[model samples]
Target: TNDPLVVFTPSGKRGRFAVGTPILTAARQLGVDLDSVCGGRGICSKCQITPSYGEFSKHGVTVQGGALSEWNSVEQRYQDKRGLKEGRRLGCQAAVQGDVVIDVPPESQVHKQVVRKRAEARDIVLDPSTRLYYVEVAEPDMHDPSGDLERLRDALKDQWEIENVTADLHILQTMQPILRKGAWKVTVAVHLGDGENRPRIMNIWPGYYEGTVYGLAVDLGSTTIAAHLCDLQTGEVLASSGVMNPQIRFGEDLMSRVSYSMMNAKGADEMTRAVREGMCGLFTQIAVEAGIDKELIVDAVFVCNPVMHHLLLGIDPFELGQAPFALATNNALRLRADDLALNIHPSARIYMLPCIAGHVGADAAAVALSEAPDKSDDLVLVVDVGTNAEILLGNRDKVLACSSPTGPAFEGAQISSGQRAAPGAIERVEIDPVSKAPRFKVIGSDLWSDEEGFDEVIATSGVTGICGSGIIEMVAEMRMHGIVDAPGLIGSPEQTGSDRCFLDGRTYSYRVYDGAAAGGPLITITNRDIREIQMAKAALYSGARLLMDKFGVDKVDRVVLAGAFGAHISTKHAMVLGMIPDAPLDRVTSAGNAAGTGARIALLNTAARGEIEATVRAIHKIETAIEPRFQEHFVNASAIPNAVEPFPILNS
Candidate 1:
């Protein structure tokens, strides 16, 4: 008989398996990480998979109910003991019998999981571009013989002192109904304009909107899209939510997406629709959570890197792929939400912060505004670590910015078993120097695998692959434990005098966790994994060094890690890994989602938009790709804490 064809949804990875082939084995062959703490013995019960037995048109796979084998004694025993949820089966015990489609939920996969979304606490003065006006328009008199729109405009000008306000064609079509329904007393949503432009009426509602008017401040990250629903009146963030970028299905990183666009004719358009749809979903979610109509969000501010910015605006990012990477436009954009296909008020204005350069984009400008590196007397270095690390350094007198290609290693890409920071992922690790015994903690659980009562805690989610932060700490801990050397070579048993270190073909591997006996897969750190981390960190550190050299400063007084990944990373581990320059531990801190906060500030204060625009223009951009010294810096930075540059603060 022909082998069974198994397909995994969302990722669209598929493989053919022989009769009785375990689902876990299929996932492994397809490079999908499913949590399995007990190898394939089914004791750990971590390799749980949900098989969807129906036509999955999106994935082009139809799974029959009898495609997989029945529950074996091992799975049944574990289920009786631990109480497995209905419709969930152990991937290790449930073998493939025919064509099947498996849905690896967030809890099952290491790379995909619930993203963290928390608004950064900051203060901003309210000066929103959107304002609501409740006006009582004069009844149209046959004697006066004035048009309804003209009468409405006269009322807005007379009552609210809003001058020269105009309505769009769509607004005009629905204007009469709203005015008549409100009995000539309606509320109008006005989008305030700058000194150069005239204010325009966005939305018209029957009667007064008793609820608060809202605006969305969005940080369109390559990996995650976070949004904050702010009260336009008070500038307070009423609700916050985030979702993984739907474009992740197309490509995991920005450059990959750009490449996809280059390869496919409609790639850019497809990605644009995916993200806009995701934003619309988020808008609906925030509105429901805040108990307001989605139309109440009359204004929005968006900040993203150059690629995401282009994709969101439906601009083809093909030019961004080559040297002298050109941006479609570096200027701050003011467009209609409808033009971008965002499901907000039809006439709502969308403000995008200015892009700093070809690589450094509006997100960088937002970060600069949030941190205000130029406002400080002391030299300040602000680093946003993502697939591309954006570096800003300087004081009030001079500010320098640069973009470094760190790849996606820092975000859990490029590693053999790497994943995004998510529940069930191994987030923290420790190894005993003597025995080389490893103990670690997953994201959802508080207890380490070796700690007491960990068995009950681990039952929630089994040990998955290492995430970004976990990968960093694991490599740093390996270096500290003498499992790996300065040049990033894993030590052999003969070299380290420990059995935990062993040879894997031509290279050596360090055993991080031995779970075979417990039915979990053996987790090991290969020499290649170390090199990937080194390359990523080296690029980041080299970029910072280039800026420091240009700024004529050997050391910065303060360092701000500005991003979600930065927020969770350990400063000590970062220093040990040479991901950043040396600084006093306390002096280095994360500026949790500073770009998102900056978007919020711009959403609330129109002046802030101008302030960031001016700041970005004043910032001198250093192109690391063109810099000759970047190679030298990267070579030195490849070693832990740098091979040449003395990290006196970190050494102490």
Candidate 2:
């Protein structure tokens, strides 16, 4: 006679088990992701499952009665003390009596789905690299002559089915004391190795370790360094922080930094030290914010552009500065935290995503991973706007990537009366088409300049200056109101029919706010400021157009802006300036900090590392410097809203 048939729901995994077999045992045999913290002793209550009765057609299983054994003493005691939900049974204690169907709830699954910011985006499942396992080792015996470490390894294999486990020298030295302290029972944090690594023990606790380990996902950008501290078990973000890159003292951009390294003898080493010091400071700040011991951070992942990648790894970036732009290496890296002088766990492992090209580095690969353009059916264009822009255009069939040198103007560096996106910076703007009068909103206060109670709100963080987003809107509004001409020239006050426009030297300036009497700088938009914005936006549009030419497509179905500045910039203004190709306004949306999200994804799911590595290989890289049409596109894009391209959607 055949034994009872067991079928698990949601995964559709089926198996045949003996009459006395436990549900938890069957789940483990079938490789289901049911969680258990207390080694199935009914203490943690993490393996609760609900069984369904009277299933007729699916899996050919039917249950009339007595499909599961009645609740035992341990379960009864647990229910009496803690109270289990109705229709719930502990997988550990419930024995199969007949053919049965089990439904594992989302809460019981070890890898639960974490929803992304956008509803349409794919959800990330929690499958962390490191995990905790509890084991009971045999006591040392003089007759057996087996070492304590050998017994522990044997226990792990016998109880948890883990084999070929290794440990560092430090773990070896401390193993004896910890084994005796826990009385032969200990909980070990193991890094479940990937293709290139073997399973190794990261840390050990005396007995039944209750605390969870942590991982750091860092997005190392040229302008700033950002980090997120996350819990490995639950996939929760504990704290988020950022600090300036600090290498800015050497140079403002990548090429400038490379030049500084060439001009100065010790410039490369000085920059390497500065960036590492800044990173350590950021790690400490975040660890303090999360109120956790730094030693608990067991894993970390970093994503960055090529120059920053080279600098972080202590490689000189001279190769990336010259023609052909060859990188030192383009493969993913795995190392220990101590190797990089990071003060996390002494043996904490770090993974860096692969770089796509010499200029299109791992940051672009991170954006592709987060957006998953290769998986999309519709043609999509993803633009990560920053000091240097990374553009990707692709679909399910193929994908293309390129990098453009847009400069630091977009970050409010070169523009006059500009500042970073801090409190009191003007972030929103509007201008009346006929009168050319302007009203705007700063970052701290939500009220418009003309609204009541606006003065009170401004008393604290007075209007300081305009930011990147503010500059985009300021230029776009000027074009829309006929204040700035198509050639990026501000008309005279009489010609523009507005007293706000006045001749400053030979050219004209548009005054948005005149508060000099109130001890505030006279905030105005100069002709040179218009020229800087024109150059920045033109470079951005030129790169996108170059990718379009290679793809043999006239227009993309959708556009996704993926950066901090992209998240806040006005889509209407971007279209007016022709910063991006013309498309339906509704189809253009923002994926806030896509590169950072990708880093978090890789941190939480180890399998994503291989997936992005494969995707990077398949992607085709286009060099914008070599493309002849790039210069042509730049010239046309220099004019406000393009000199040749037509925006039918915006005109309508």
Candidate 3:
């Protein structure tokens, strides 16, 4: 009988195995590293794999049911005792029954992903909505016959000076027991509502609960979701964690995800569940890191593009796929954590930043709030570069914002040998002008590939592939070294006078790095890769140019790159590649996940919610699709440093 095929992702290893062969056996045969400390006995449970069931058109695989065998006795017993994660199976016990795509989570693999997201350090004043009030109520007197609840209400009013405080319906059921336990002296956790709304008691704890109140701030990016656990009282970030947006398997970019929702009957619901589950995982992680109970997270603030904003709320994004891009709602939202199925306090509140437009969603609003481009005296340009680049330009007088479809090239989706920012992924690159040779640094190691003792490091974790930042630097360096011309064409060996330049078949290519081991693939930059970068950069520059034209400014005084990818990219390369308008290099800096930071601000300070809400309303929204000059600007910006616009600063 023919054997079943099993493919492992992040390593891209594939193998064929007979029936009853364990997944760990297949992985080992293919040289894929999966942790198995107990020698396939299923005791450690470290070798767990998630079998992706469905059609993955991009990878040309269709995963069917029974691809992996039913849970064995060992796996079942382990799960019963130490709960296995959803969709995960013990790789040693689960046998291959048919073709399948297995995802070895970063934690389960011997090699792990190097998470790069960090909480941007900023001081914020504490004005959290959740407040602790210590109250002393008169014990229920049989002589007076005043009810326990009524007397407690009166005491709350007299002691805390809070009026119209109502308890949640669940709180009422256990009120008597909690009152008796506290001996009428209890600390009530009150959650203040929006303007004109009554304050409500969220939790009533016996005695003074001296622990710190916690809140979560989340930036739900199209590619990644990051979370920060903060002390609601001190406005201090206690822990930060991030996970790859699980929706990537469904589709790579925003429009693709929207398209997936359009094509698949239950696509929207599936994506929603995936992200919520991912968020739940992050919540558990941050809570453990902070040494706090999961229920203590009483509040959360989120920011994401409109698509993510809609999907997270279970809204269909079908209309967003068409013209006019209708949004179900653009106003800031407040919903119960349980409504969204988030793992937090039962009565916790979730606040979402307002969406600026159909394309420019709450993430852009969060960027505007964190950067405050509208408050600047000089012309300020803020670009939150990602799959979709959101541009904000203006000063105190006027602000203009637009969204450009830059695609996933910048995030390493379209490029050959491209991968997400993992441990072995190349993140930094430098090209020597003299020899036209390149050296690079991977995420986990500090030393460059050309430096001493680099071979040992590369031996441990092989050079994986180029990431977003490395792509930017590679193209910019190619252009600077005259290996690429003004028309975005890679030069031949005769023209560049470098052996590194050669023609692969019809088009020219440059060797970036030789393989670390024999027969390993050489990292090469093809002409097609450069074109992908050009198209991505052109879209970004054109969007910024359109915003600048709306602002009636020739050049921006400063440029702020906002996002994780933006923070990692070199400012000089961004300018050289015409990804942003010309500005002094010193004035160009990263805002460092501005959306996440803005979410944190809103979580700690309620006033910020109102401030950004007003700011988004006052700002003008320009639709790039409707603009006529967008195409012309895009064509001109496709060239390095732009063909039409003069970058005198960079030229000097």
Candidate 4:
């Protein structure tokens, strides 16, 4: 009765399916695998598509109107700079009324995530205070009277270049048995430097062989949890897996969880358990795939943003969300599975990377570590863009960090047409302003049947929404073409007669109703959508500028963008919109989830845990709330993109 939902996917395949289905549902029906981060709740914005023709229907639930507008700040800029245009719907939010086709852009973290790309350099630098290694004497038999203790010291001296070895209470108790079992071959594991010269023997494997050990680095993000199984010998990531951060039930943003924690202690504990369970499950699955026993996972590293860090440690996060924004702990902790209720080898060491401040948590530390800021002399700026954007700047000499509440704008929380990045969602849009024509990409095409159309695409995963990235692109595009102005006014008086940016007398009320344009029935960008983007970009830009001001650098030698946005962001577009500072396009690099990378580093080399902590200490955090400069920066950063003005690159 209707044209099928035509869809194209990342694999370069195309398919069509019948109506009345979500994208993910259709994906599974056709034996396709599309990862949905929001679990089909229409939140993650991971599944996105471009629909050619289809009816979009919803239950008509009343969403708060004032929260978003047809234009205010964000939209005008989006239209002018990014070249985004109408019908750039989040895959989860839009439904198919008829035949529609779409494309999935390369930037979306859908289908898969960007892995931690690490350099294979083992010129390891560990904190002398925390990393410890001791060689114990092998028990000399009747033929050899050197004694077990003496043999161990000799091995330690020969290998570790240490004159003396220290043993802890637990190590002392088992030394004799260990010597007997291993024929006097013992390796003591301790923080690199032993103040007492006593090293704890983590394990007494038979024989005197030195093999690479494995560790896991984990980034416990509020929306996503990533674990990198790494090799300790040469510092390499072996096998890694990432899943949704399981804490979404409490609320989407960190503030919700913090408020919940303050209200109910039991709620806090439950939240902690949820994340721990998720992390443990991922750990077990990854270890099995890596051909390693559960016990082989000895050391683990973890770094989470403030609230997530608190939830993972069972610490109260209430203060972090409110005035005086306090943190429960800032020092690095050496813990065991029982401490955090994590399921791992019972005796394995757990290192939680230190947080710099209440808002700027360990995620920043992970970013700094992954980029190795101390090794460089050129200025560098690190921006971790998420619900909360934490920024940092410096070279090898000095580094300054700050946190900005970017809201959930980038993640598409408050926008009207926003949906999780998923199938049936219009992931990428290339619009020609003069012709008012558009080309789009969707998530799933390889799995659709020719008979069906938008229904098959929408059914893929029951996709119901759009996310932050899509919103940014859309807002930028709309602003650039004069659909919206610098102040977010819907339509200009000059283009009054036939202008269709708004309908129904509302600034953003244009409705596609039934048969509409190429992508199907849809109202394009709204005034409120523009404002949401303005706030988000402002926060990111403000944070970057503030850090630059602190360090007195004009243009950073390198700009490292971190977190979800980092995986795929156009440096040129980002600079044009002033979302990030202007620099050589190549100088702006993406550090795919540095928090996860730091976690992997901790997992692979437990001793490095101390090093990471010290690095966090060196970092200085600028509180945007208290710092008047950030407020001023934010006010200016909030302006929508103007057609005539050049995007400013802040200098001292």
Candidate 5:
């Protein structure tokens, strides 16, 4: 046996590494970057390679047939040719005892976001919230019993009626010295109070950090992260750019991550480091791309789910994984950029919006800001569908929110073939209401319009797999055509994977193959896959229904959908799956990435910190697992979105 494992790519990319080096690490040393989220705990089934006949440890689990364990989380080959988990292996955990050749999945990446584009900021405007101001005070004369600092404080209290006049150590360090240098001129970043005594100072850009105080807003999602460089002088979004979330390294769904975090005391640290590193990298990239100094990022607003928030802060998420799931901190947290190890300006202030519960996080709070729930009386339902789905139901008087364990179904997970919103991912699809043929548009190409030669178009270019949005569309189409039963059971010949099946030894079924990938079919949606969808959709539906029942509201007046997928997927498709309530077209609104928007809000406005804290305290949490009825509701919700009624129009 070789002391060190040896692996090579088909194209002669080969290298040897210490025996202790995992396949992914070995691959990297050998110039191969493998994709293994969960920090390579051996899940996701993304990194898989076949051993060069006889080169693998007979005892070591193989990702190929006739050599590995019976249970491969990703592929079936682990057990026998009769059962292969798609030849999947976690590159990070799977150590090579011998030489092997591996193939990287198209979904694989060295980092989550390939391009981190920065946006140009809009003009700054000062609101009642706060601002970065430079002031010059008169030198203390003989009659001035009050010091220069006192004089400055008096002017602030007298002119703006501000109460809190605190100074940082850095600010005070130069306060006495600078009192004479610029004739007592200083720039202070003050966070204005919201009619309460929540006064604070975010920063003091010494030497007249001239011009409007610049800040950023960030909406961090489970799968994607977006940033908005804003001018604090004006509350407008200066520039905005978004990319996939880097936390995906852990898992695709919230529970999976929560489970992963329960490993040990160090789990939280690992999770937090992964997120911080990802964010820090993005911040540096965006700042550099925007042609701005990182120091200019003085303040930022952050909003995300409770798990995501915890992960970003390096807090343990294990508590949220079990019964009576609770949040680490529902109230808003204000931390210096350096504390969380975010690579923004050292003095930069980052405020995380308050969480409604362990599930409904600052994203909901941000959306609530838009709704101004405090002023409304009608029943409003705010549904944010991400890896973790948060649903808020109530009126001005009382509100109830519960986050369901809806995995990446809506974002294209658990489906036969699902993925985040990216190039080659199918964004839209239209089935011939007549022939039942499907015409879809791949995100990278604007070819859905090539209606006449759809097959030729796919053949010429390349069609990989149906994305989450496309899957929803196709499922909706199947339901309409009676090809799929209401409960998602494949119908007859034209039903299910029948006509399109492939030869899987004994059973032959419809095979899903993109033009580019014909060697092996990716998603052969089995009856089990259909059941998973049924369970997911049902959970979403029953959860919404139960919330409405609790609030004593018949139906929601308005439903706001949040998150990357929620904003983009067709509402009609969502309704078909019963993922959302069947409301009027106008009743449902798609607010693009409310979490990301809220993050940006915190980044730009320091005053928002207190407001978010108050918001967290104000909102109520609904524990879904409290009642046994929830299980029944979930089981019922597992059917198609809307059984047989007219589906709501999903207008963009």
Candidate 6:
């Protein structure tokens, strides 16, 4: 039994194989992750592997030059056409000649891990719903009297061990021609199925499909619809894009949109059509950025607010706008692309995360999935700030959730000279405590307003307006430098000792920038703008405090500011404005778009879909609207950093 010893690196899986055995066969026998779509036929080059040869004292073996057989004709042919990397060999063609160590590159492994950018976040493991399989089928014969599809199924069952597979009518229509075209051998993209679904064919190719499929992880916000087009097999984000929600013309906030539906007969339908069109456009842009065909996208996962969820599904949101705030359904949905008129693969699967409640929607559930407060030992609070803020407070034993209607003030709506986060929008600000002068940075430029070449930096997108994050820091800096009072009012020049503060309409306004000479609009923070921010932050704080009350806690170990806006807001500025609860500044972290991350998690791992569903079921929902304590907290939170609740960390 003088067999060659084969060892696979990164996994440390070792086994003894016959000398002439194919590396792929040896890898399969030892449970190594070597991929192959065309079996051992070498038609697909997915089974590429690199072998090492040297003295190996640690592994207790001495490698030689003839460890693996020389590349065969199939490898040479593949290298000539597609060009394999130097020193790489096709595992399906290379035979084990002696003791050898093989390394499987990340791209070659089917379940490779996709590293996340966040230090504390979990990596996404590739385990998509749809996968490709190459199989050979017997051609149909009149004498045998067997259908082509039956023979294909038999081939799948015999070759791949897949059972009871079904195909859509579209596949059936083209199956005859494709089967004959491939000379009875074809590759089929199969949706492995979930819940009550049966394994079915999504698409078919003549032979082995050289290209991989794609999936979409979408975060459908009330203001914007964002999507991440990802490689299904690799879990890599090929492109990310977003578009402003077209429903903004109808209403800026969720409640207004709901009211519009109630007021107009066809308002709901019109809004639905607008949103759908917007989503389709976003998909097209994302696909183009990734340089892939839209039809290659076969799976999608969506996380959205309750109202958006209902509207997207063509359901009237009247119940969501009233008392009790009942949702039509809160279950996770699995559907087809055509059911929603999506322009992706016709048979693509769409999975929506489960909703937490009428107010706290699937977006909150997605946040929970990504942040996972329920699994934490330390009591953590997660706040997803937007038009409406979704707040969660919990630990290992219990968790409570609530929603606060923060409105569109945070997104720069309903404010004089305010705009969304865009180029030329002021995003960072700092004021001198003595001079009472301000220096700020706009979204598109890295230079500060007082720095050299600042004008040229903003020349293209010329100082437009203040955005949500900018307004937060501006007001916070105003309060810090005594330009604005704790009562949320801008002071007069005499009272504040700042000449930039000028009286306007019986109140005062702080002039951040005066661009009149340059033919640009004069940008100022009016008394009303502070009031809008106060209302938005108060609602956000009250929601968090309401959950704290329900959880019977006055403090939390950590605070995760989640959302695109949250990622940019300074934690110190946020605390000065009383946007969140008291916590160490270091403990207060930003989880950029946690709901979108959760959607990506669900898209890559099918098991995560079930995990989030179970988590959503266990979460306790608190209705902030009905709770009297919410009013009390709202009043207290209206002041800068709370009137009653002391932020000891911020104070220190």
- Write the number of the candidate with greater TM-score, choosing between 3 and 6: 6
For each of the candidates, the C-alpha root-mean-square deviation to the true structure, in angstroms, is 24.3, 2.1, 22.8, 24.3, 26.5, 2.6
TM-score of 1: 0.79
| Model 3 segments more than 4 A misplaced | 1-123, 142-147, 516-519
Per-prediction TM-score: 0.79, 0.95, 0.80, 0.69, 0.70, 0.93
lDDT of 5 by residue, 1-652 (tens): 3444353543345555554466667776666655432234332344555444444433343423222223334333333433324555556555655445555543453321212122211211123245544555566779757676677676556544567676556655656765566556555667554433255555554445545555767777766677777655545555667666665777766677777777655766777887777777777777776677776676777777778888888778878777666788777777668888877766566667777776677788876654444446777777777555677776668767777767666666666666656666667766555654556787767667355655554555456566777777767766665556776666545444345534444433233443434342354445555666676677777778778878775567777776666667787777767777777767677776655655554454444456556655766777777867678778767777544333345322
Runs with alpha carbons beyond 4 Å of true place in candidate 4: 1-198, 208-212, 444-465, 492-500, 509-523, 552-558, 602-615, 642-652
Clashing pairs in 2: none
Question: Which residue segments of model 6 deviate by more than 4 Å?
Answer: 1-5, 16-20, 57-66, 69-83, 96-99, 118-120, 375-377, 455-460
lDDT of each: 0.84, 0.90, 0.84, 0.62, 0.61, 0.89
Candidate 5 global CA lDDT score: 0.61
Give the poorly placed runs of model 5, Cα more than 4 Å off: 1-129, 140-164, 173-187, 193-210, 242-246, 449-461, 494-525, 600-618, 642-652
Looking at model 1, the pairs that clash are 37-520, 38-519, 38-520, 39-519, 39-520
The full ranking of all candidates by TM-score, starting with the best, is 2, 6, 3, 1, 5, 4
Candidate 2 or 1, higher lDDT = 2
- What is the TM-score of candidate 6? 0.93
Q: Model 1, range 1-652, lDDT digits (tens) per residue?
A: 4787888866889888898999998998898867643346665555788887755554665655537898899988988888788899999899998788887765665333222235342446566787667787899998889988899899888766678988889888999989999999777777878646579887887876545578899999987899999887656678999888999989988888999999999999999999999888888888888888887788899999999999999999999999889999999998888999888887778899999999999999999988888888888899999889999998899899999999889877788777778787888888778887778888898898888987765565666678889999999988888888888888888888779878888899887766565566677788888999999999999999999999887888989999988988888999988888888999898998899888988988887889888999999999998899999999999988688999899888
| Residue 450, candidate 2: C-alpha displacement in angstroms | 1.1
